[model samples]
Target: MSDESAENLIAVGVHVIVKKHNFSKVYKVSENGTLMLGKNQKVEMHEVVGKPFWSTFEMIPKRGPSKNTYSLRLVERTESLNDLSGLKGQLSGQDNRLIVDYGTSQGLSKDEILRLQEAGKSGKEIIGSLIENSTSFAAKTEYSQEKYIRKKERKYMRFLTVCRPTIVSLHEMYFRQYHEKIGGLRMDALAQILCYSDVQADGLHLLYDSGCQGLPAAAMLNRIGENTSGHLINLHPGNVPQTAIVQAMNFPQELRDRHVAVNIYSFLRLHYQGESSMLDNISTSSKKVTDHIVERSVEKLNGETKSDEVSRTDTDISELETDAGENSTLFLRDAEKDADTLKRKLHEFEEAEEAVPVKKPKWFLETQRALDLLNSSKVRGLTVIAKEHPLNIVNALLPFLGASRPFVIFHTYREPLQETFMELKQKRNAINMRLFTNFLRSYQVLPDRTHPDILMSDTGGYILTGYLVQE
Candidate 1:
């Protein structure tokens, strides 16, 4: 073919010769346009398509006029082609022009294609990196791989760029799912289990697996020490495992001496038995103290009531009869006195309740810890946003709730649990319960509202949080 013709025929359906040395086995194009040959024989042909971005394509066999008709040669070329012949060669005889054009139309670039090849990375990785980097490209190519990596990676460092905010959003979405649908107990239990599972301790430092896509966990952990009271060291993902050991070793000797707590969350596991034991002791002691206080309060109230009943019964025989004879007047006086006494008693009880130091509910406390860890200097928070999930809601409010220190529960719209939130609200005293709904009007109308001790948000699937607001 003439050079001009060859140039013009660059479009699809062009015919070309195979470079013989590239393949050790001989193969020929079949009538169906697939490659066919002996198991041992091989040959290289010009790719009419492009590189395989995701999957590998295998050549198939076809029947022809000759007994050895497995092999065939192209006799002609077509016009309307583009210059993808070089890429076609690199992609093992696939249709380079077609693939390249498709990718280009989707916003990929030649340089990106090269980088993608050089990195030996998957399409998913390339796409993720591009989005995370927020590469600037033409509108069509904003999400296109070719425009982002080959062009953008040169200007931006993926690791140096900020991804924590987006990751944090995602984390919020996941927690929302947990809080709205899974219930607070399950959410706390899952977090605790994951945290404990990830813990790693050595003589020097403690390492833990903050969990997959850990930016959110790290952000939450950092916020714990700042917003609430806790001692936790947050670690970044890249420096983990090694940095964990270093931190574990270099942890403040003073804190250790004072029996202060040190919590670490990463992918590594804690190796020291002593540290694990310390954590267990703290958990056990706290639980014991709470139980004892509750038990004592119940006993004291019961004792007080029993004594009052005995005194009232003992005084009244003939006096009660005389009082009855002057019944109307005496009864009115006594009823008024009783009402006054009851009012006084109610006021006293309320004051005592207010004076009682409320322990934060487990979910709020744990979530606060996670938020503190996320905000720590050593770690950066990554928010994860999902379209729908309970975990997302929980993660989002975790910081706010921790600040407010409110009790939380999640109830769903379906099954035996249906309308359970409404029932609980009606049954509980107004002071003890507070509900926050997505319904905008309800949020606006409620007056005399103190910040909820228990803050609840719906997952659209269910309601979360019940009981006294902790803050």
Candidate 2:
């Protein structure tokens, strides 16, 4: 073929009609590979040629035993010679429907045209498909000049191998589907869960897991804070292996003393089996809890009494003295009386505090710290895995949390955990908490179902999923 004739042929889109040697067999190529057409069914290709060829037909069986005895024949050619400059000029005055028709005539689907309009499908993809299949469908007319299609096909195939899935599409598809099933939780809930559960108050305890959902969760929590008045905290415990301590030190000053004391003790009891002795020592000696309580009580007493004169009376001096005189038998009787009197005063203070229904200060501190961390752009949401007493973790977290909040927790086949969750629904305090469970092996959430705000998995291990809430 003449150079100009070859070039013209290459520029046109090809239509290939392949007929089988035996009427019993039929074939066609698609994105998924080759499919055997039904008997008497013929295979036809439309709008196939451009610079790169194989885009017109996907290669089949990346690696497998070769089948050499295949009958292949290409029997028709078609060319697309639309004037782009003229089309562009006419686009403004012409109806969109008419332009779409023109695109369809050029072998592009409506969806493909829309994609093109959106700049999704690259120009190369459109051009490549046209070139590769044009030769096979070229007719005996002047526009049907023959040329080597294999060279172009090989080059296009190489391009396909290097192409990566578009990130925009991947994220859109993944999150769209994820939200659809999960009832579209806001980032605030996620941030709150992460900040409170994952990040400790001291900011030294960091949760490490392969699937990081903190960023999204933190984003959600921030939104929540704007809508309501609340605090959030995020703690990151650095280096798990070296800190056999798991550092309850990260808890807020108040929580470190009371609420977390109990929980941390439990967590340590489970985490360190043979080393309970070490945990015991830390738990008993770390006056952090007492200090927190003392500070909180002092604050409350200060708030109740307007004058600073009574501040000294609110001090736990008697308790301190009792503690200091523990070794002296002679002072024991005096210490006991002082201790009893101090205990009564403390009980009265606690009762008055309870009358106001203030939340456990420690819980609030822990939750606040967690929320703060989640809000930080640098940290993502956390994954909480509770191997023992998953319900306790849930109870501990749920009481301090707010409504329409985002948090994910998991539990195994433990019937008690499920029962506990069911029981939580009865309490007015638990009205805001939503729970979901996945018994299936797949981690994927479907697009149609109403996904739980919190998803629990029965994989025999309790895990909290989703982003951390930031405040």
Candidate 3:
């Protein structure tokens, strides 16, 4: 059920669409589910559960049918096609020994048609009877006959199909259904991300997304592989995480645990300052407490924990000190305060690491744990897709990554990306800078009668991709 390409099989908690004749509606599959169509037509979950998606079934007739008591006829959509031809060709004139004056053919009477339709006959049988009853039946062209059959089949068809939701299927669904909520990201753009990023199973991906309710993350998760789990680091703004895309993806339980969400605020605290900055601050400060923090950091990383105290801390004091140095006044008391007050503040800072999280999420972790991850990371790539300009963010994040780490940024417009490209081009830390926009059009594939769709999406935003090469 977790596989992105795994379709046909119906499962609970997945999105499905019930299609009957010309009417269709999408639904989340669940047990004992019932859907009322038009005024009287209804669907039951038991009729669809364990059935292959896209397979059509018919409503079984019963006396004074109650909603719950109705049964289904597994009318295999292709059951009559057991004798299908092995070859294909255009419907030529006179091939079926039939020609018709489409303008002059008088259709059967309504009463007569109703009597035939209510005789409990199959769609095929009903169509056959109507064709035979037509006054011009023997004079219609083969193509005309096929055209007539299709038109009537749609009106009289009583079968419904359960459509499977694949990436393409889901994309169409989202693009058409909730275009604005999912950041208005076109399907082609989504496909482009999966290819350009080159993210795969077992690879570590760091992503900052503030668009379309976490849809980019979910897309990457799906591309990484349905059966093989992938590690994803989701970076988002504010305290509450936006993983709407993850919800839409509907990953299985085992795979859902693989996603780790870290707020941008927490990520910046540790990533903004390096060890060298901390050491410089330590040399300048007269506080011996900074040295103690450095020692504990080494000890903690080396697995030399002597008690539960150090282990419980959210982050080491030295970790905080790195962020504190830039805005030292924020953490430090006024100059008028005595030395003891400053030392007491240091202890309180140290104790904060161990304090239970109040508003932070514990599923992946709080800010302190994110700070720890900041120092211990070997992630290979970064992907940014946000409503805000990502230029300011890319510059700050480049130095934290190892050499030759690729990063891609997506935006609907090119101006922000152009600015970032210029900055990276001058710094020399990023190479292979290129601006990209996909020109995509789909063709309708049919023998001797195919052409590009009458209309297509003209644009799918811009992409900037490059690698960080430390000087």
Query: Which of the numbered candidates is closest to the native, going by highest lDDT?
Result: 3
Model 2 per-residue lDDT tens digits across residues 276-343: 45445444444456557766766555454435334544668776566534534434455456556666
* Candidate 3 residue pairs in backbone clash: 8-53, 98-140, 99-139, 99-140, 99-141, 100-139, 100-140, 313-353, 313-354, 314-353
Q: What is the C-alpha lDDT of each candidate?
A: 0.33, 0.34, 0.66
Provide TM-scores for the models: 0.22, 0.25, 0.61
Per-residue CA lDDT of model 3 for 305-344, tens digit only, reads: 2343345345678766575454445323332243455557
**Full candidate order by TM-score, most accurate first:** 3, 2, 1
What lDDT is obtained when candidate 2 is compared to the true structure? 0.34
Clashes of each: 93, 57, 10
Q: Which residue segments of model 1 deviate by more than 4 Å?
A: 1-406, 411-418, 422-471
Error of 1 at 218 (Å): 7.8
Score candidate 2 by TM-score against the native: 0.25
